[model samples]
Target chain A: MIVLVDYKAGNLTSVQLALAEVGHESVISSDPSVISAADRLVFPGVGAAGSAMEEVNRLGLAPVLKDFVATGKPFLGICVGCQIILDWSLEDGRTACLGLIPGGTEIFTPGPGSKVPHMGWNHVGFYRPHPLFEGIPDRSHFYYVHSYYPTPSDHADVLAESDYAGVRFAAILGRKNLAAVQFHVEKSGAHGLRLLKNFCAWDGGC
Target chain B: MLTKRVIVCLDVRNGKVTKGVKFAGNVDLGDPVEMGAQYYRDGVDELVFYDIMASAEKRPIDIAMVRAVARKVFIPFSVGGGIRNLEDMREVLLAGAEKVSVNSLAVQNPDIISQGARAFGKQCIVLGMDAKRSDAPGLPSGYEVYVQGGRKAMGIDAVDWARRAVSLGAGEICVNSIDADGTKSGYELKLTRLIADAVEVPVIASGGAGTPAHLVDVFREGRADAGLVASMVHYGTYSLPSIKSALATAGIPVRSVP
Candidate 1:
């Protein structure tokens, strides 16, 4: 069974429905036992990082998520869920993240002509091929709505890259048994659905 | 580059999508769920549904309708109209809409913007500003903010309200021109550019898109980050692909139809 962790951060309904669209059924669960029992974890979230972190800690999902990732079943993180897994984030007055990834998150300070929120459809340029990106073409456009992005310290950890505000940032990242994407696959139209479909079948290998 | 978005607006009334000329003499369209799914399949970047009469009626938005649309459409969609408080926004988001837009309630109580932003991430909060061209006194940019489905002018400057709402935590702004709505001539370029330049967040130009070229005009000359359409596609005048092709031919960056 696939479980979409509920951290009270953002709506997981679209994620669940998207999974259903791809012929995969999933449940939204914050309960540790249910999370641990699930075969895969789809961590999808949006909203403030600090508050999202607070909710995770409040729900005591940190360790369960950590232990689940160690099992190597299949885990995918989207948006805030992707950013929060990093070591730290500069948002919400410098919030410390789950530290699953190498580095921290920083705000987008792109030069003039670039919006602060950096909201819209942008290109995700894949740096290296992986099973999660199986059928998705390179440099595919995905819907993005975030002011900050994950900046992994190790370049090898980067799965895909996308640019905004004149600065290219890691748009997709991966470590052992876990994968993360900075865009909302559920909202990215057909390609987004295709990526979600791929993730559903991914075995967490590069 | 972050390509400009092409969003379709469905003015839903009593579960059916409706469109009118300048917010009057409405015509009933088909089901919101069916139309929303069709547009999604046709390659729209996003969708926005406004409950045309909910604010004046003083009731909650139709969650059943939202859920109905959510089940069929997989892309990002924002729901507006009749949203009163944080709970309304929460309900819509939980029902599967990506963002909850506030218009009348936002004008009546500005705090709802900040409150909604805090409760749901700013990314989930959209400020739906309905404005009309007015040379009225105290109105800057020659436009005044209108609420209650564009029936009442708030005497507040549209540009000022847009900037203020962003400061209070509006992730995005959808500027709809009442004068250009349903005209099928073109968008209100002056008003769209004014608000787009004022706010740092992405600004969507809503109302008055008759042809694909009209969208190109808004994206280029109006400096809009996105263009919102109602009549052109809803009435079967244009398809999403044709409109996107026009934008692409104009040398403006836009996502190709997949």
Candidate 2:
């Protein structure tokens, strides 16, 4: 079963619904035990970084997540969930992150004729081979809604990239059993569903 | 590169998709969730849900409906109309909405934008503006801002209001043209360009979209990040796949169907 970490930051119903649509059984909870025991874990978020981290700390899921990652179980992070895995975030000033991956999150500054927030659907170009993007075509568009992005310390972890404001930022990252996409695969239409399906059927042997 | 977006909006009222010509006469289309899901399956980028009756009812957004749509639709969805305060925004976000859009409420209480941004992050707060050309002197169409689904006009310049909204933490802006809504003619290019140039946030040019060419024109000529339309897509006037194809052909990069 896939365990979806719920921190009361934003709705997890869409993620749950997407999992269901792809024929995967998942449970939504903040309980560390469920996360530690599940075959795979998904951290979904859609809010501020500081507050979301606060919930993770409040629920005592931080250490549990770290342990889970250490176990090499397949892990996935979406949006702010992806950002929280970084070393830190510069949103509303600097704040510590999960430290699962190196680097930090920084606000996007769109150049001339560019727009902030980078809302709507944008293409995701794969940079590295990973099980998470098995069926997802290269340059496939995914729904994105965020103002900050992760700059992975290890370029080897970079899995995909997307362009915005004249800067091509890292859009997907993965190393070993851990993987994540900054875009909302849950909301990326059929191609997105395929990504989730790939995750469910992946045999990463974590 | 970030591809331009072609969005099909569903202005839902009484659970049915409805569209008003020039934001005036209302006509029913079909089921909101079904139509929305169809668009999703057709390769549309994103979807917007505006409860046309929310302000009149003076209530929060329709959480149950949001939940229903959010259940079947996996793409990012945004909810607008009657989003007055943080509580309202929180409820909808909890109900599965990725973003909550505010118009009159944000105008009435500008701090709500910053507060929502502070709590949820700037990306989750979207400021919507209904604009029209004013005939007054020293002002471009007066650029008067309208509220309550374009029923009441606020004598504020549209350009200045957009600038202020961005400063207040609005990550994106949806500039709806009251003069061009449901016209099927095209988007208000001049108006969209002015607002897009004024704000650094992503501007979605809404109202008066009829064909694929219209979407192309707005994204290319107007330099809009996205185009929002309702009636045409709901009534089967244009299919999502054809639109994306046309956009691609026009040299506007779009995500091709898998």
Candidate 3:
């Protein structure tokens, strides 16, 4: 079973609905036992990093998620879920993160013409080959809607890059059993669904 | 590179897809869920289900209808109309909507915008403004804000309100023109441009979209991030693919149909 961690910081129904549309059966849970036993896990969240981290710590999910990643099972994170996996985030004024990934998140600098939040469909160009993007085309468009993005302490952690406001941020990042996307794959139409389907079939291999 | 979006607005009343001219003279088209699914299949970028009668009638938005549409549609969809407070917003978001729009309520209590933004993140809160052209004194932009589904004018300048809403944490803004709505003439480019230029957040130009050319104009001239269509797509005047293909041919970037 695939467990979607519900920290109650925001809604998980959209993610569940997307999974159903892609012919997958998943349960939303904060229960550590259910989450630990799952064959695969997906952490999806939308909202500020500080509040999301609060709920994750409140539900005692931070350790459970860390343990799940160590089990070498397939794990996927979306949007804000991808941000909190890092060591820190600039949102809500220098908040601490899960510290699983090397680096932290930074607020996108608003340029002369660029807009913050970056709310729209943008392209994600893959930097290397991986099962998570097997059938997905290079530079495929994905729905992105966040002001803060993950900047790994190590540059090698970035698997896919998308540019905005003169900075090429990681659109997708993978480290062993854990993989995350800065965009909303659940809301990215067919391209996103295909990504989810590929993650479903992956066996946690490089 | 980011692509421009084409959104289809279904002004639903009583669970049926209805279209009205300037928010009146309703005509039932079909089931909202069914039409939304078809549009999704046809490659629509986004969908908006606005309860036309919800705000005016002073009733909570149809949750069952929202659930029904959210079930059939996989892409990101927003629900609006009759969402009075944060409770209503939470209920709709929990029911499976990615975003909830606050229109009339935001005008009455501006604090709700900040509250919703703080509680659910700015990305989930959408500021929907219904505006009409006016020569009323002290209105700098010559456009007035309307509430109650375009029934009452707030007498406040639309441009000023848009800036204030963004300052309060609205992630995106959808501006619908009451004058050009259902006219099929095209969007109110001047009015749209004012708000789009006044705010830093992505602005969606709603109302008065009759053809693919209109969308191109909105993105190029009005600097709109997205275009919202109601009667055009609902009445079979244009198909999603046709419009997107037209946009691609015009050099406006759009997602390739899968």
Candidate 4:
């Protein structure tokens, strides 16, 4: 069973509903054992990083998630879930993160005619062939609604990039067993569902 | 590149899809969930469901209805109407809506905007404004904010309201023209442009979309980031694909339907 980590950040229902659409059975759990034992873990959150991390530590999920990531199982992080996996976030006054991936999240600066939060459907360009994007076309539109984007300490870990207002940032990051997206795959329509399906079938080998 | 969003608005009342002219002359369209699913399949970028009677009736939004629609729509969908506080916003977001839009309640309590944004991310909070044409000297843009389904005017400038809403952490703004609603003449381009230019957040233009040209005009002239439609899509006048195709031809960036 796929375990959906729920620390009560936000929008866990949408992710659960999206998984159901792909015919996957996911258990939303805060239990460490359930999460660590699951074949795959999907950490999805929406909200401030500081509070999300607080909940993670309060529930002792930070260690649980770290242990799960070390198991070499298929894992996915989305939005704030994706950001919290990084080293730190500039949101909520520079909160420290899980450090699962070598990266830091920074807020998007408003450029000429470019809105903050970058809320809209933007194209995702693939950097390397990965199973998570097996069917999703390069430059396919995905819904994004976050001001912060993760910048990997090592550029090679970047799996995909999206350009908004001439600022190109990491949209998808994958390293071995861990995969994370800065956008909401649950709300990205067909392409997102297809990506979720691919993740369901991913063996965490590549 | 980010594509311009085309949203399908379903003005639902008592759990049924309803449409009215300028917020009156009510008519039931069909099942909201089924219609939303069909629109999702037709390649609409987003969906908005506003509970028409929630605010006026002093009732909270219908969670079951929002759940029903969110179940079928895989794309992003927003729920509006009667969201008075962060708890109400939480209920709707937990019901599976990607965003919560505040209209009359937002005007009554602007703090809900910042609270909702802080509780949930700014992206999850949407500011929904209803505006009517006005020529007051204080309102140079000639628009005033309306509330309670356009039955009451708040005497606030539409442009100023939008800017303040964004400052309060609203990620996007949906502006509906009270005078242009249901007329199908076209969107209030002047008013929409004024509000769009006033805020950096993405602005969605609502009301008065008779044909594809209206959408083209809104995006090209009004500079709206998105367009919201009800009658055209509700009555099967134009499918989402047809409108998107027209937009693509008009040089507006839109997602290609498979």
Lowest lDDT 10-mer window, candidate 2 chain B?
A: B135-144
Model 4 gets an lDDT of: 0.90
Of the pair 2 and 4, which is ahead by lDDT? 4
Candidate 4 backbone collisions, by pair: none
- The residue pairs in collision within model 1 are none
Q: Tens digit of lDDT per residue, candidate 1, span B104-189? A: 78888999999998888788899999999888889868999998888888899999999999999999999999999889999999
- What TM-score does the A-chain of candidate 1 achieve? 0.97
Those runs of model 4 whose alpha carbons end farther than 4 Å from true positions after fitting are none
Candidate 4 per-residue lDDT, tens place, A85-171, comes to 999998879899999998798888877567777888888999999999887889999999887889889988899999987779999
Backbone clashes in model 2, listed as residue pairs: A187-B74, A187-B75, B134-B141
Candidates in order, TM-scores: namely 0.98, 0.94, 0.98, 0.97
Q: What are the DockQ scores of the candidates, in order?
A: 0.80, 0.70, 0.78, 0.80
> How far is each candidate from the true structure, as Cα RMSD in Å?
1.2, 1.9, 1.2, 1.3
True-structure RMSD for candidate 1: 1.2
DockQ-based ranking? 1, 4, 3, 2
Which regions of candidate 1 fall more than 4 Å away from where they truly are?
Answer: none
lDDT (0-100) at residue A55 of candidate 4?
Answer: 95
lDDT of 2 at B36: 79
Question: Per-residue alpha-carbon lDDT of model 2 for A41-123, expressed as tens digits?
Answer: 98988878888898899999899999998987789899889999999998757989899999888788877766767777788
Candidate with the larger DockQ of 1 and 3: 1
Worst 10 residues of 3 chain B by lDDT: B68-77
* Candidate 4 lDDT by residue in tens digits, B1-258: 888889999988887899999889999988889989999999999999988888888899988988888888988999998787888888898899989999888899899999988888788888999999887777767899988889898889898899999999888999999999999999999988888878888899999998989999998889899999989988889999999999999999897764
